[model samples]
Every structure is written in C-alpha cells, then in structure tokens.
Target: MAPPLVSLRVVLLYLRVLTVAFLVITVIILSTNSVTIVSQGNSMKFHFKDVYAYRYMFSAAIIGLFYAVIQLFFTISELATRTKNPFNYQLDFYGDKIISYLVATGSAAGFGVTKDLKDTFLALVVLDSTDPVDKLFSRGYASAKNKKLSKHQSP
Candidate 1:
C-alpha cells in the first residue's frame, strides 16, 4: 500500500558511497600529477598548492568526502532503526546545498586554470610563440568575458 521506501533508502546509501569514491579519486588526481617543464636551466611546475583553483578543488573534495561520511551515518541509522525524523529532510536539503555550492566554486576555479594552463602548454610546444599567443589569447579571452558579462547584465 506504499512506495518501496527500503529500496529507495538502499539506493541512496549506494549513491552516497559512489559520491565519496568519486571525490576521493578527484582529490588523488589533484594532489598528484603536477606538471613540470624544464625551460633552460630553470624549471616551471604546476602544483595544487601553487594555484588557488587547485586548492579549491582539493578543499571541495575533502569537504565532500566528510559530508558523504556524515550522510552515510545518518542514512544508516535511519535504515537500521526504521525511523524517520522530521529534521532529516531539512538536514539533507541544507547539506546538499552546501556541497553543491562548494563543488560549483571549485569547478569554476578549476576551469579557469585548465584553460590558461592548456593554452600555455600548447604555446610552449611552438617555442618562442609565447608573446604572440598570449596577445591572441588576451583578445579572445577578453571578448569572451565581455560577452558573458553583457549577457549576465542584461534583463
């Protein structure tokens, strides 16, 4: 006479586990695999700690991991006890919103870094193409940003 609440709960539990796993994987990737290149006797490297964006990525991943653990605890308690608390829905809603905000901020920061780094590396491959490539990138990026700004400003 009712919905499959147990099945729903089980599915949600699995989903939380999957989310934690994904965040852990992202943290690992961001923490390791820093890019290093030797130009002349000097070397340049891109590391998570050196970039704010990568730091955001790491922070988001860690925060998400902790949130997932807390969620798992509440969800497990609910399932085992077969009890529903009025606060669970509100708690879940707020938790989700907090996680979403963190993830979005991290994603935007990561995107900016990714675009700049990708262009820089590509230009590096051409050797001595930096100034011209940078000028071109400046124009293109400026135009794109202007368009985005204008759109956002419009009614």
Candidate 2:
C-alpha cells in the first residue's frame, strides 16, 4: 500500500509538471496572439488583446497555474503526513472539481474565439481575395445558383 501511494505521488508530480508547462505555453501564446497583414501600404492587425473571449481564456490559464501549484503543495503535504490521514481524498476531489470546471469553461470560451477568428480570417483572406481556390469555389457557387434558378423557371 505504501509503495503504491508513493508511485501515485510520483505520478501526480509528473502531472503537475505537465500542467505547469501547458499553462506557461497558454500564457505566452495568449500574450502574443496576433497577426499583422500588410497590403498595398495598408496594414491591419488581429490579436487576442481586442477580444473578450480570449481574455477569458487567459484568465483560465492563470487560474490553472495557481491550481497546479496548489495541487503540488497538497501532494507534498499528503506525502509528509502519515498514511492514516483520510482527508487527502477529499482534498483531491475538491481540487479536481475546481480545476475541471475551470478548464471546461476555458475550453468553451477558447473555442468560441477561435471559431469567430476563423470565420473572419476566411472572409477577409479567401472570400475577398482573387486566389485560385476562390475562383474554383465561386464557379461552383454560380453553377449551383443557376441550377436553382432553372428549376424555378421550369414550365
């Protein structure tokens, strides 16, 4: 039993390390999440700073940082205490619940932001531009519209 608990503690340590690494990456990406487009001496920028949903994601990442550190602390404290301590299970459950809800909310918010950004980018870069792919899609659309019109006009 003691050996299994030790192994579990080690595993938790590794998990915390991975969680911290991801949190750092999330912060950096959110902080620098922007792209600049220059065309014909005009420039436009798209970045997370201008989006509220992205801010929510960044906030979640910061929350995750604190959660991971606190989890690490609890893990260490559990190991330092005697094995008969029954409160560790409750602590684990509470920690997991809080982190779970936070991550779920973050995921939802991030998804909404990404979908919006994708639509905007496509409208700007694909629909309005004369790229070869756009021409192909445009031809298909015209044919579809013509077919619909012909069907409506049929005697």
Candidate 3:
C-alpha cells in the first residue's frame, strides 16, 4: 500500500498545477477582452458588462479554489486523525469520526465563501437584475436544490 502522506502530496500537487493553469487562463481571457464603450448622442446610453466568457471563467475559478481548499483540509484532517503506525497492528477506527467533522466544516466554509464571491461578482458584472439569479441556478445550485426538494417531496 502507498503511504498516506505520499498520496496526499500527490493530490495537493495536482491541485496546485490545476489552479495555476486556471488562473493563467482567466487572466488571459479577461485582459484580452477588457474594453470600454462610450455613448455620446442624447438618446444613446451606456452600460458595463463583463465579457460573458470571463464571467463564467471567474465563477469556475471560485468554485475550483473552494474545492481545492476543502480537499486540502480533508487531507490534513485525515493525517491528523490516523493512528496506524508502520510497525503497529492496532488502528483506531474512531479517528474517522474526527475526519467526518473536519470534512463537513471545511466543505461548508469553502462552498459558502465561493458562493458569496460568485454572487457578488456576478451582481457587479451582470447588468440585468435577473441575470444573477439565472446564473446562480444554472451553475450548480439548481441541481443541489432539486435534490433537497425531491427528498422532502418523496412520500
């Protein structure tokens, strides 16, 4: 069996690479598309909007960052709670309970932070009032909400 620490290190390295790649992509797209529009006629009007693609990319980055943090926390918690030694046959199954609490708390914080940031950014960039709500549901929350609703509605 592979050492637990080795596996955790591999996972963290993969996440770091993935995050750097995403950040690079986001910067490239956002910078390349940045523009300003001006309207001068009496009837003309102006509004600012995020490049739609950049908005999506920003949201994805937020989600990815949250996921990476949560994963790292879980890995750390697992390492802390493990009781098995290479030369010892005794193992504490109760360690898993601690891991569970750590995972739950980490996941909640990660998701909440990501959701709040995404909502705020979307509100700033989306000109229409309804666009944020539409984007929120379409991204991932709708499926999660539907699952909860179905659980409650089931007889």
Best candidate according to TM-score: 1
Ranked candidates, highest TM-score first: 1, 2, 3
TM-score for all models, in order of appearance: 0.73, 0.69, 0.32
* Per-model C-alpha RMSD: 9.2, 15.5, 12.3
lDDT of 2 by residue, 30-107 (tens): 676565555555666656667676677667777767877787677667667735356757766776667656755765
Model 2 poorest ten-residue lDDT run: 146-155
State the local distance difference test value for candidate 2. 0.57
List runs of model 3 lying over 4 Å from the truth: 2-33, 36-48, 83-155
In candidate 3, residue 86 scores what lDDT? 39
> What TM-score would you give candidate 3 relative to the actual structure?
0.32
lDDT of 1 by residue, 34-92 (tens): 54544555556645577666676668768877887788788899789877698988878
Residue-by-residue lDDT tens digits, candidate 3, 1-155: 55865675456445444544543443333334322322232221211123343344444444444544454455455456653343221122233233333333433433454467457755565343444334433433322222122111000
Q: lDDT: which is higher, 2 or 3?
A: 2
lDDT (0 to 1) per candidate:
0.61, 0.57, 0.38
* Model 1 per-residue lDDT at 73: 89
TM-score of 2: 0.69
